[model samples]
Structure formats: C-alpha cells, structure tokens
Target chain A: MKQKIIIAFSVVLLLFAIFLIARDLFHSSHSMTDASCCGDDFTSAKQVDSTLIGYKRIRIIETGLKNLTGIAVNEKGDIFACGNMQVSIFDAAGTKTKTFNVDSVPGCIALSGNDLYLGSGSHVIHYDTIGRKLAVWKPYNNEGYIASLAVNGKYIYAADALNKRVLKYSPDGLLLQDIGKKDSITGAPGFVLPSLYFDIAFGSFNDLWVANTGRLQIENYTSNGHFQSSWGSSSFDNSGFGGCCNPAHFAILPDGGFVTYEKGIDKIKVFDPTGQFLSIVAAAGSFKGNSDFQLGNNHLVKDIAIGINGSIYVLDAYNQINVFRKKNL
Target chain B: MRSKTQIYILVLIISLLTLNLPAIQRFPRPEFEGKYQIPATQVTNIQPAILQYLDIAVLIACMSLISWFIVKRRWRKGVFWMSLFSLLYFGFYRKGCICPVGSLQNVTMALFNHAYKIPLTAVAFFTIPLGFTLFFGRTFCAGVCPLGAIQDFFAIRPVSLKPWIRYLLGLIPIVYLGLALLYAATGTDFIVCRYDPFVEIFRHNGSYFMFFIGGALLLTGIFIARPYCRFLCPYGVLLNLVSRFSKNHVSIAPGACISCKLCENACPYDAIDKPTGLSVKNDNRELIKKLIIYCLVTPLLVIICGWTISKYSGEFAQVNFKVRLANELMTIERKGEPVTPATEITTFRSSGKPVENLYREAASIVDRFYAGSWIMGGFIGLILGITLARLTIYKYRKEYLVNKGNCLSCARCLEYCPVK
Candidate 1:
C-alpha cells in the first residue's frame, strides 16, 4: 500500500511534466509555420535589377544542358559547353551547331587551336574541331575529381581539386610535373582549394594562373612550375572574394584581365592584370533565386566564357547562359 | 544432463559455425550479354511524417504488451516473441531513427533552445517510456526498445558479474547521460546517435569502425547479457530512476512465497535482491545514525564532484565544431604556420562571419559546460548517497524480490518460481 502511494505521486509528477512538454511542442509547430510565412518563392533577377550594372542582357539562351560544368570560347568565337555526358558547340549567336557524346561527364573544357581538350573523369581526351576523337591522354592519378582544365602553346594544366594539386601535362598527354605542392625550397605556399572550384587560365605570356579558392587568392605560377605571386582578399564586401571558395569559374579577357564569376552571392566581376577589382559587370542581385542558396556545389558557378567581342557569358545554377555585353553609357 | 562446460562449448561452436557460413558460400556471378544498368534505388519510400506517427503507435502498443506479459500474465515466452517482433519492426523496418534513446537528445535540445523545434513524434518517443516505467517498471527495456531486443537475442550463456564491479561500472551511464545532454543542449553534436553500437547492424550501411564495434558488442552480449544497456545507454539511466518508483513490478512468485531459492540464480542480469536477515530491534539504531550522516555529507560530495568536473569544461566544449575550428585557427595563428585551412575553417572565413564573434560564442559554450557539468556531478553524487543509504538500511523479506531499479522486466524469473 505504501509503494502504491509513492508510485501514484510520481506518476502524477511525470504526467505534469509530459503536459508541459506537449504544450511547448504544440506551440513550436504553430510558431514555425508563422515564422516562415513567406514561402520559398525566389526573387527573380528581372525584379532585382532593371539594368545589370554597366552590362546589357543581350541574350538569354536556353540550352537543354544539365550539370553544365564547363564553358569555353575559341578564336573563332565558337562557344563550347560540356555537361550531361556530352560536349556541345554553339555558334556566336546562341544557335546549337553540333554535339559529340562522350563516355563520361567532363568537368572542364579548354580550346587551343583546332584541338579541344576535355577533363573527363580522370583522363583528358582531345578531339578535333569537327568532333572527331583525336587522342586519349594517358590516365593520371586523379584522386576523385578533375575540376578545371587549361591549355597553352606547349603544356596542358589539369586542376585536381580532390588531391589539391595542379598537374601540368605535355600536349601529347604525358604528365610533366605536379605543381602546387607545399615546398619550402621553392617558396610555394601550395593551393588551399577547400571545395571543388580550382580554376586555371593561361595568361598571354603563357603563364599559369590558378585560383587558390580557400585563401581567396589567385596564384600566378611560371610556366616551369614556379610560384610567382598571388593576390586577393577575404572580405564580405564587393572588393573581396567571399564564401568558402569563390570565383568558381573565370575566363581570361582579351587584354589579360579576368572575368570572374562568384557563387553564394552570384555575381560577375572583372579584375585587371594586376589583380585589382576593376568593375562589377553584374551584382548578386542580378541573379534570381540565388540569395538563399548556400555556399556549395548547388550554388556554384557552373561555367564562364568570354566571346571575342568581350561579351561575358555566364552559365548560372539554372543552366541558362546569360550573355552580358558592355552597355552604351 | 549435460555439464555447464559442455553446454558452453556447444553454444560457442554453433555460434562460430553460423558466423563462418557466409564465407563458405561463394557463388559465381552470371554473365550478361547486353549492357547492364543498375536500377536507381530510393533511399526511403515512406513519408517521414507518416512514418513517425506509425512509429509512435507501435511503441505505445509494444510497451503495453510487454508490461502485460511480464506483470499480469507472467509469460517469459510471450515476452520473447514480442521482443522478436520489435526487433523486426522497430529495428530492421524503421532503420532505427525514431528511437527513444536518441530522442533524449532531441528533448534536451528543445527544452534549452526555444527556436529549435522538435518533432512531436520525438517528444512522444521520449516521454512515453518514462510514463510507462513510472507505472510498470521498464517495460520498454523488456521488449519495446529494438537495441535492447537485439542484444537480448544474443544474451545466451550469460555470466554474472561481481557486485562491486557492477556498482562501479554503473556510474558510466550517469556520466554518459550528462555528456549527451550537455552536448545536445548546447547544439554541439548528438553523441548518442553517433556512437550507437547496434544501429550499424540494423541499417546494414554505416561507418566501417561502427560495424566492427557492433559485432564486438554482440560477441560480448553473448556472455555479458545486454552489455550496452547495463553500462552505456544514457536513456537507461533515466529509466532506472523512474522504475524505482514504479507502482507494480514483476515478482518472482505469482502466489505465496515458498522460499525454495529456485529463482536465486535464475536472473542473467543479477537483478534479484536477496532477503536481508536483519531484524528491526538489533541493527536499527546504528543504521539510522549512518543514514543521517550520509544525508548530511551528500551536499559536500556534490560540490566536490562538481568542482572536479568543471575543471575540464573547456576540454568538453571542444566537441562543438565551431569551438574546435576556433581553437585550430588560433593555434595556427599563434604558431605562424603556413598550413592550408580545413574545409570547415575555409567555410567559416568565406561566410564572412566575424572571427571574434566565433571566439566569444566558444567561450560562452565553455561556460555552459562548466555549469552543466557541475549539475551533472551533483546529480551523480545524490544518487551515490541514496545508494549508500539504501544499502546500510535493512528491509524485512521472506522471499526473493526483484530489484526494481535494475530489473529489465524480461519475465525470465517467472519460469523458475515453484509456487506459480
């Protein structure tokens, strides 16, 4: 009988505790709905900016491209975009010209003369301008991803973001030297990639430029794999690179400047040869529905390219290439 | 009749052979002519909301049935079958997500963080077992909990541990509960779910080390009888307290006590308490004096324990990612090291959040740990004092009694009762 009394008292106490918890849970569920009253409807780019800062929206080309990973333009102004296990060629006017099916999805594409280089899976494949396969480069020890590709007169550079190293290869696909390994003797600080946004571009003098995204710096390396200098700043403001890694995609302008595209705050900015922030071609607000996208692949720059006439083409998260030209001020 | 040694060898041989059967059956793969494409597999078929409701309903039903079998029907076989059903439905089918043990963290998080909303199912999962235990004594542990049920299946050829060792190891659950609650309340990590030994086995895909740990625990369970539940499960610490105040618990005998001592060695978990031969007239005065002294000294014990644990509050706070990242960045800065920042550090810097703000937040978390550890230590001290007091005092009994706090309510002792 005494045991029963103790148990009854404890049961009442537990019941009261349960009642309090239930009430709080009920209130939380209702309050959560009220807090997110504005559903996830994204603000469109048209609504955010009537004029996309010093650039006119010349074209909104619609391509049936999914996972549009890489975009490049050749001397002939032909635009090449690779994704969805295929490489597509578009004329200067955004008309699809030809498509070549590939075995694996290419992470990046680079154009030299008439030869198109593709960083697909762990191997680089070369093809003629007319889509005929040329040579399959010997497979390199790619850790997991081949994130970016760059081609110069004598060498091809593949940025292996997974291994956090850049591989310089001969035109015939023989691995030459591994760049970006931390070496005190060479005074190279190596690459701080963080996420898969390692981009490499060839300068006019055949110098190599790699984006050490984690450090928010673009590193300049000599053709012989020597670190020259690096410049960028980690800041939330307009002048600096922001997020874990940014300038996810960038193309070399004709005059040796860089047209860089950033994720998280989806924007396009131009930098001069000396790595100074030149001007904002497009602000983050110019892209619709990207404000809430977090810093990752889902919100990363899919691809970027520059036409011969200095038009900036940006393949955004939505797979639409927005061509921006200089506005007549 | 077979000897105990012979039975042990036989069971070991059978278990070993069962474990080795997979290696023995090596089949060749069939060749296909056309190109083969693997079908895309959906991770989960059921909607999470609907599945949560179903899980709660099943938990309530299983708890009631387990209590009925152990207390009213006194059927060990019935309880065993129910446990098997629980292992199938809650363990394999549900993939071990909406579990009461892990839900303890969710409840703690909700209580501490007003902005954090816990699913209604998680609250029910946490509270229902406690409510049931207050009335019926750990019916959830008996069969409803899939973790317990899976271990119970392997609890064959069990060995009894020494009372001193059992008491010493019993302190681990209280400490684990404290750390789990501390981490959860501060939004650091869910240590319970992360370290759950049996969940890997249920899911069939998890960290490789966890799989080995699960296998090792199952091997230990073959001899130790629900080792995780006795020594590690933080939720078990909560259940043990509620069960002590249970209104009705399983008794060894259904009718009159014959004192035949048949159930003395029956319990594999060593939950049976022997009768105390002390009479009220002899040891009453000395026992009362000692109990009063222990009660008076318990507060001092609490303060001492709290101080000792608080000294390591900074170390404990490192379990949070932000605190850890800040510490790493500070270390790198102090050393002037040229090492590349990790992904987490890069993300933090890229997000443009103020580094000083991160340091301040880490300091505040350390403060929370200091206070939480003190309360946890004080709690353990109180339990220790109560345990000592209970042991020194005497209770008059003629028959074997189940230790309410320790009993799993598995109903195994019911079969040994002669008066039934």
Candidate 2:
C-alpha cells in the first residue's frame, strides 16, 4: 500500500506538471492574432492627425507602366516617369505628351536644359527631349548602382547606392571625383545607404543635397564635394522619418521646402528650408481603405517630384503618379 | 529465446520510426514590422572569450575532483558537494552555455560543413570529457555536467524501474544521438540545445513552454533519478560507449562482495549487476542457432529501415528553415493571394534576390536529406541489432560488480557495502 501510494503520487505530480506545459504551449500558439504580435503598434502609428495634413491630392495619373522606378520634373513643367524600359513624359495637366524607349530600365532621370540623362544600370545615357541618344557614359565600375542623379550647371552628381558614394562627373562622361567618402578632415560622414534608396538633388543655394537615408537625414554638400549641413529627425511622429532607411526619395520644393518620401511608415512629409517640421502631405491612411497595403509590393511611395507650380507628383507603388496640391486653409 | 530478442528489436525499430514522423500542421507565426520590439523578459549576459576559457578550466577541475572522490576517497558526500558546486558555477553562473552536451552539435556541424570553423573551446569541451571517461569512467556525469547535476539534486525519491522498462527507454538516447547528428550535419538546427529543458531553468528566462518542461522534468526526476541523462541526453551515449572500456571504474565493495544484496538495493540508478552462477550443462547447439538467425536478420533489418526512412525524407527536410520558407512562398503563389507583408517574405523581396534562387536552394537541401536519412536509419537499425544480441551473451561471475557503461561513478553504493 505504501509503495503504490508513492507511485501514484509521483505519477500525479508529473501529469500535473505536463498539463501546465501543454496548456502554455497550446494557448500561446493559438492566442496569437494579428493585433497581438505587431498589428497594434503598426496600426497605431498609421493613425495620423487629420489637421496635420496640409495638402490634398487633386489628381492621380494612372501610368500603365510596370515596376516604376522614379519620377523627374523639368523647368518646362514636363513630368518624366521612368520604368519598364521606357520613359513617359506628361504635361502639368496630367496628359501624356510623349514616350521614348531606353536600351535598359532606368533607375533615375534628370534634366539639364533640353537634355535628359538616364541612369540605366551603371551606364548613364544622355538623351535629347526628342528621344535621340546623345552619349552613353561607361560605368565607373561594373558593380555600381546609379540610383539617383542630380544635375547642376557645372557637375552631375550620381548617387551610387552600391558604392555608397556620390560620383561627381562632367556632362561629357568625365569622372571628376568621388564625394561623401568618410573623411575626418572634410567632416563628411560618408553615405550610409542600407537599402538602394539613396537620392540627390541640387538645393536653391547650388549646394548638392544628398539623402543619407540610413542616418535619417538629408545632408548638404558644396558643389565641389565638401560637407555642409544636414536636416532630419528619426521618430514615429508625423514630423519625423521612421524605418530601417527613410527619406527613400526626396526632392527640393520650388519655395525651398523639402518634399521627402519615407518607406515602412509610407508617408510623404514636407519640411522648411532649415528642416523645421512643416506638414504632412500624405500618410499611409490616405491609400486604399486606410489599410496597410504593404502586400503586393505596394508599401513604398516609389518616388516623388516637385512641379514648377509647387505640385507634389508622387510615383506610388501601384504605377500611378498622385499629384498633391496645398489645401486652401 | 530467439523470438524474445527478435521481438525486442522489432519493437524498438517500430517505435523509433513512428516517433520520427513529420510534425503536425499548424498556423505560421505572424511577422511584425515597423518599430515593434519583443518584450524583454531576461537580459542574457554575453560571455567573453577569456570567460569561455575559464569555463573549460572549471570543467577540468570538477571532473578531476569527482574522479578522486569516487576512486581514491570513495566519499559520496564529497561527490555530492562538488556536484552542487558545479550546479552553481557551470549551471547558474555560466547560464549553461558552451556545455559538452551542446558542443556535440558544433562538432557534427564542423565535420559536414567545410566553411564552419568549430571554436577551439567547443572542440576542447567536447573531447576532454570523452578522454576522461575512457580513463576514469563517467566522473564527468557525476559532478561536472550541470544538466546531470541539476537532475541529481532533484532526485529525492529515486525509484528503480523494471528491466524491460529500462531496456525500452535506453534505446531513446541512441536514437536521439542519430537524429541530432543528422540535423546538425545538414545545418538544420542544434536540436539538443533547442530542446534542453534544464538550460532555461539555469538561465531563469526563456520560452514559457520550456520553463514548464523544465519543471515537469524536475518533478519526474524525483522518481526516475537523472531521467534525461539515462534516456534523452545524446552526449551521454558517447560517454556510455567510452566508459565501457574505461581502465578504472567505481566499485561497490572495497575488497570482496559477501552477497549481502544491500548495495544492489541502494543503487538508485540501477547500475549494480548481480552475479550469475555458471550453468553446468550448456545448450551449445541452441545458442549457435540463435546467433546464426541474428546474423542473417541484422543486415535485412538495416536495409528495410534505410528504405523506410528515406521514403519520408522530404517530410523531415521541412524542419529546415530555408525549405519551410520556400514552401510558404510557393503556397502563397499557388493561392494567388497578394503576398502578405510577412517580415521574411518582404526582406527577401527588398534584397532584390530572385525567387527561383530560393526554390533551387530548398530543393538542394531536400535532396541532401534523402541521402542522409538512409545512413541515419541504417545506423539506428544496427544499434537495435547489437542491443538484442548483447542480451543473449552471459558472463560467469561470483561477485557483485558495477556495470561500467551504466554507472555514473557517483559512489552512492559505497556506503551500502558491508565489507567496507
């Protein structure tokens, strides 16, 4: 009787302990829902203050191009949307004006006077407005990814996302120097492009503005490739950029404001000349049904361009260019 | 008599094959995005390189002390106190990492993957115990191994199980050893470390399910006495084989056994073997017939098991992370649903890598599993055959002796010896 009681007690103890283990495992595996793991945090961040939205989308131009890479605007108010091995030009009224085929898919496009420059893979091809190839610049290296191109009166700065540096080249395909290299003497903090989202544009003062996306800041450099100043902050709020690498694409406004497109949070924000929190042009909630449509590769804003009328033309993931105008306050 | 051995071998093979089947289907874990962080339950202190060397030094010191206590001193109190210290230092202080039991996976991984550089500390931790076991039996298990020490501490009312129960459970560690090696060699996972119930208890933080498992095992240890060491530990299989050939081993009596049978009842782990008198009239012809039948059946069993396990090799390969990810992607594509923003899938897409590359990698790993499963299955079959054959052979003895392979050299039976 004594032996049987001891054996019975041991069995019960082990069974009770095993019951606790099984309950925990089963409950944990079953109880996890969309909101439990991560949805609450993401949904909460997507909630933007309606009053902070300073711009209303007036036009959404449906470009039937697949895999749209970037958008650029010229002084003539012509919008050049590049993707799917072709460049489509649109008038300020969102009418398709002209289309031209490139030898390869262009990562970015820039305009200087009447000439159009396309960063097709490593090679940069110069084209006239009429679609005639002017010159093809050989790749600085085979592994270079010329993600963004900025044109000044004297130099063309290409943001090489693969090389993590800005390539300063002459218009005629001459490699002048490399900018944004980590240097203590020049105080350049180098380019920290975690993903292929590095962008460059010329500011109003002729200083080259580069998006240091990994550091969540837009840095200003001299035309001769010297570090100047940068502006941006990392936060979950509407005024700041959030994600692994934000400000994926940025364009200078006609009034010297900054139009920045951030991924992950999928927000288009604007800032003053000195990087003051200005207003939100668009948030993730502005998309279809206010749902996080990160599925189907539609989570990113793709690219942004500033028109001559200060209209913000956004190349969204759905292959549509959304045109936003300032709301009448 | 022949049928008994045959039945035991067949039972073992069938049980192992059934247990090795594919896991049940369940919901996939949801991937979180944005700035969400997993709640911090415990902060793991990363050990420095110098501290890892110190761990190795402490392991050597404990093993030496336990061997002396068992052999030279024959003091159970010394062994118990030293193991308690090992439980504190190696278990609680070091957080139970870099142990010899877990290092078996590292050694297996290095052997198969040429790119993998096995750490010098892991190589030492894995080999030093085997060397000590060959010379001084399983003194390491008595006081050095924290996993064994923790279980030993919890064995308050150790019960000796029946012989058939012991035999059935003994096959588990061998099978576990085979599966652990197969997974490690294929770069699947270090299952030994992943499922170690006591490691979480030592760390005071981990998955809640694992915490309950640790508690359950400890509760079970109160009756079974170091249940994991006897039935679950893959590393114990290696020590058991090496200790069988040890030059010096723990003995119950100092000089001669008077057949009091007190030490037999005192051994909680059932490591003591009673002497069997010689049979005057031997049945040589019957024994020869049984031996002949076993020889013919052993090779046939190996081939059968190899073919059986290889049939389900693809299912087993599902445990591999790369293979599972490929399957998930293929499922999503087949369903024609929009690719959800699951973290793994999105990360793959943003990396600009082609989907075809992932499919090809998963296929290659599955193909490797097919070949590996055959060898693993055949090895398990051979172990069963050997186990059954050993039961048939009897050695003549007139005195009680310690079963070297089964003994942990803990010296608990030393006090029960009337002659001493």
Candidate 3:
C-alpha cells in the first residue's frame, strides 16, 4: 500500500512538471515583444524623442546585401555609401533615394560640391548628387580596388593602395601625376607596411591624412607630395589604436577636434586637435541583421562624411546611411 | 552466444557506417524539384556533426569488441574499459556529440521545433540503431550507445529495488517525451543535447565532473541493468515499443528454446520475457481491471498534460539567441538619427547572447531535479496501474491455469518446461 502511494504521488508531480515546461515553450515561441514597449531598445529603432538626446543604439533592418564595403556622407545631409559594384544614396530621412549600380563594385565615396566621386575596382566614377554616373576614370593598369579618394579644387587624389601610389588627376579625368610606385615604401617620414593606402583627406595645413591600413597608422602628407608627421598605431583603447592594422580614420571637427571610428571594435571615439583622447561618442552597440539599406558592406566605416552643418552621416554595408545631426546644430 | 552476437552486430554497424551512402562531399543527383541547389561540397570541410556520430559508432564498436574480449578471453571485467574508452575516445577526438543521447535530443526537439536543424547524428543513430532494434532486437541499445555502454559498466552494488518499483521506473520515458517537447518548442536548450553525460564525455576533452559521472553510471550499470534504457531514453521507448511489433520478432519460438532459462539471465537488456505457459492461473481479473484503469488514465494524461504545457508558453524566448548575429546587428542599428561614433557613451547594450538557449538555462536546475523525482513518480503510477489491471483479470487466470485450457496447442510451452 505504501509503495503504491509513493508511485501515485510521483506520477502526479511528474505530470505537473511536464505541464509547466510545455506551457512555457508554447508561450515563448509565438509571442513577440511589442516594439513600442521595447522603445529605445533595438527592437524599436523608431522611438524618437523630440529632444535630441544621447545617442543609444543602431538597428540593422535588412540582409543579403553583397559586400557593403565603404561609406561617405554629402553636404545635403545625404549619405553616399559604396561597394565595389554599386553606390547608394540615402536621403536625410534615412531612406534610399537611388542607387548607382555598376558591373564592378565601387569601393569608396568622397562627396564634393553637388557630385559624389566613387572608387570602383581600378576606376573612379563621378556621380551627380542624384546618383547618375557622370564620368568614369580608369587607372592605367587597373589591378585592384581604388581604396581612397579625395578632391580639392579640380585636383582628384586617388590612392592606388594595390599599386602603392597616389594618382593625381584633373576634374575632367586627366591623369596629372602618379606619385609612388609598386612595392616602393617611399621612405617618407612615417610610412610602414604599404599595400592599399586607404584614406587621403586634405587636413588642417593642406596636410593630407593618409590612413595607411597595412602600417596601422595615419600618415600625413603635404598637398605638393611632401611628407609630414604621423600619429596613431594599431592601438586605440588607451590613447593608442588597438589591433594590428588600420588604426585611424580621423574626421576633423569644425571645433578643431576630431572623431575616429574603429572597424574591428565597431566604435566611434573622439579626440582633440592635439590627439588627446576625448569622450567616446558612441560605444559598440548591438548589431542586428540588415538594418541599413544604405550601409553597403561590412568593411567600409572608414568612408564617412561630415557636413559643414555639423550633421554626420555614415554609409553602412549595402548602401544604408546612418545620419546623425547634432542636437543644437 | 553473446560474444558471437555482439561481434556480428558490431561488424554490421561499422560496415554500414562506412558503406556507400550519400557521401557528403559527393553531391547526389537532384531528386526533388525546386529544392535549394546543393552547394558544391567543399573538399576540406569535415562537418562537425559527422565526426560526432562517428564517435558514437567507434565507441559502440570498441565497447562490443572489448565486451567480446572480456567475456571470452577474460582480459578484463566490469565496465571500466567501456567507460575509459568512451571518455578517452570522446576526449582526444570527437568531443561529445559522438553519443546517441544527442540524437535522442534531436528526436525530442524535432517533435516540437519545426525549424530545428536536425543534426546528421540524429538521423544516423535513429535509422541505423533503430533498424537493428526492429530486426535483431535492442543490440544497438544493448551496448553500443555510449550511455548504454557506460551503464553496462556500472551494474554493480545496486540497492536492488522491488520488481514493482523497477516496473514503475520504466514509465519515465513518456514524461521525458513531454518535457523535451516543451523545451524544444520553447526554444530552450535541447536538455538531452546539452547535459547528457555520455555526450559530455565526447565534448570539451572530458571534464573532471563528466568522468566522475560517466564512471559512476557505468559502475552502476553493472548491477542496475540498463537503467537509461529502462527509464530515461524517450527514443528507446519509441524503438522498444516498435521493436515489439517488428516483423523480425525476438522470441523463444517453442522449438528453438530448450526451456533452459539461460538467455533470460544472459540478456543484459532485460528484453527477455517469460512465455504464458506456467503462471496463467493465479491472476486474470486483475489484468482486465488494470487495462480499464489505464484506458481511463491515458486519455486523462494526454489531455491534462497537453493543456497544462500549452498554458505557460508565453515566457519562452522567441529568438534562438545562439544564431550567428552578424546580420542581425546590421539591421537593428540602421535607420533614423544615427548615433555619433563617440566610444565613451557606454550604454547597456544587449550582448549577442542567443535567446533560444535562455529559457533552458533558467529551467535547468528545476528540470534536473524534477527529472529525478518524476522518474520515481511515473514508475509508481505504472506499478499501481499494472497492479490494478491484474486485479481485474484474476477470475480468468483460475480457469486458464487448469490444464492450460486457454493456451493454444502451439509448442511455445515446451521451451519453458524443465520437464522437457
């Protein structure tokens, strides 16, 4: 009798426990968190406060974007992000206006005036603000990606990182000067491992900030091809850029300050004119699948655009643009 | 007989594993319309799952071979060698998925989670071992599965419970089935997948605690006799019940048996049952009563259990948090006002911890505790149900006992008669 009673109690308990587990699973599988309730959280990226407050999170909205490589912003607070095969235009309101699709992916985008200069494999394209291909310029050998491009008064500087040289061209696509050569490290002041020199921007003193990716530092050069000082390394957390390669893509701020973004760590940090570490404007937040229809590819945060109006726009993988305007800009 | 059978079964399974099946690298000719084009199988790829199943196969083959050696050659005794081989085999090479426990886990998961990625191990273990169960009896379960193998080692020094207790313990598989389904649907850890001791033996190069647990089970298997097969495995229950109705049935078959009762004691799996010749008279009415009770109880269990599990289904995490989130991150961070890339603004962001495994992590402690107590509980219910059925059939047994009148004139009685 005692044995039977024990069995009876156990059977009831087992049945009950089984009940709870079954109930829990059924509830979890079908229900979704309300976006409005998950507001400011990643599930709800549309929760906008009227007040421009602290920046929080980034929500990825789409997937299947092929190689969203590099990003850049334009003057109208629009973003011109590119891949080797295409260029994406995202409007101020975070929607794609148009896409410039090419046979080969466009790697970098630098906006000037009302035009967007896009670097495709071995060629550079000049596109109108509305994303029409105006003209295409190909290098002589055209081997690999045209990694970086910068424009100053009809002078277009193209870094043939694969070719180990910067090809200077006129606005009409005329090749003017091909500086540096294949495998030549140009023993300039702070040159290191050279492959594809990634970024070249006309900085404070007509000093071009050459983000030498392989060397893991930013090299500065005079507009006339003279070498200047260099700052940064593959270390970034504690004043020095972290990692083994491509440390600095410093976007110079209007207040004589600078903001730098790291690719591997996925963070944007701020620095002063003297390279002193400032506040981290955005921390490494959670990434969801395919949020940006504008950010073209995964590896292209180095291509960003800051308008004079203090609005910052980022082109993500697959031509999606993440536009950030200052609270009081 | 044992050594010969073990050797035969081992050779068969090993040959089958290496046989001309659909080689993963060699893409099969398309059979279906509109199926996703199979990617050209990469030559360098050794799927993590294939290696895991092979580990189970190797463990089974090796255990049988060692068993053959121990019983015939007397090189060793007990399940020490089996436990050692499983641990070392799983440790040095295919860390843990090498056990059939994982496949059982998948079977449980499949019944609930439709989108579940069925590990090839599950299919292989199921089709092969289960085929053997239907044909040659539970030889696949007898010693091959590392869990069974380990338990076979431990059948020593058990606190022998009553047969009624043992019979009751056997009903645990049903409860496991229900719980496993709930978890799989809830997107919880495939509990059988996650914490199985034998699979754990194969995973992570053999943790200290796993060796202890595995060694304990094997030593216990020496005395307790197929404990996991008896009470724990839901798949075993499925295959066991199916094996009963299998075309190639296992029985004494009246003539083949010499009425020696040798195979009954020799059978480590306890699958051998006595013929209905000798003990037909004592209890007939009890069987009818138990049948009626079970008929009442089973429908109630099905309805009540199903209803109760469906009630609390809301709390389970919807996302399989372990899914590689590279794509997930990109979509969430897109749209509207982009946050500035100032690294200093450290806000509490959701870590890429997959939510699918979340509920399992929460329920693990409660689940494990409940699993133990429930097994005991289910066993008791089964005993009472069986006892009640025996009460209903008592009157019929008295008439059937006199001169074997209810027995068919078949020679099935000759096997059990010592007088023969």
Alpha-carbon runs more than 4 Å astray in model 1: A1-304, A307-329, B1-46, B279-281
All-Cα superposition RMSD per candidate? 18.9, 11.7, 15.0
lDDT per residue (tens digit) for residues A1-329 in model 1:
65445434433432343344324323322222122211111112112232335566678778777667778888777788888888888888889999888777787898888888888877788887777887877665744468888888778898888878888889888888888988888778877765788888888788999988877778899988899988777654546675447667778887888887765455667888888777666653334333321222223357788877788887765566778777773
Which candidate ranks first by lDDT, i.e. highest? Answer: 2
lDDT of 1 by residue, B29-63 (tens): 11111222222212343456877788888888888
Worst 10 residues of 2 chain A by lDDT: A26-35
Q: What is the lDDT of residue A301 in candidate 2?
A: 76
Answer with 1 or 3, whichever has the higher TM-score. Answer: 1
**What's the number of clashes in each of the models?**
1, 0, 128
In candidate 3 the C-alpha lDDT for residue B179 amounts to 51
Overall lDDT per candidate, in order of appearance: 0.74, 0.77, 0.49
Model 1 lDDT, full chain set = 0.74
Complex DockQ per candidate = 0.02, 0.12, 0.06
Task: For residues B1-420, write the lDDT of model 2, one tens digit per residue.
Answer: 523533453354235324524655221112235545544245455678898788788888888888889898999888877876887787777778879999999999999999999988899999999999999999999988889888776676788777886787787788678778988999998878877888877665677667767777777888888877887789999999999999988778888789888887777788888888667226557666777777778888888888887887777777777877787678778875442345455545544568999999999999989988899889877877777666556566678899899998888889888896
Residue pairs in steric clash, candidate 2?
A: none
Residue B199 of candidate 2: its Cα lDDT?
81
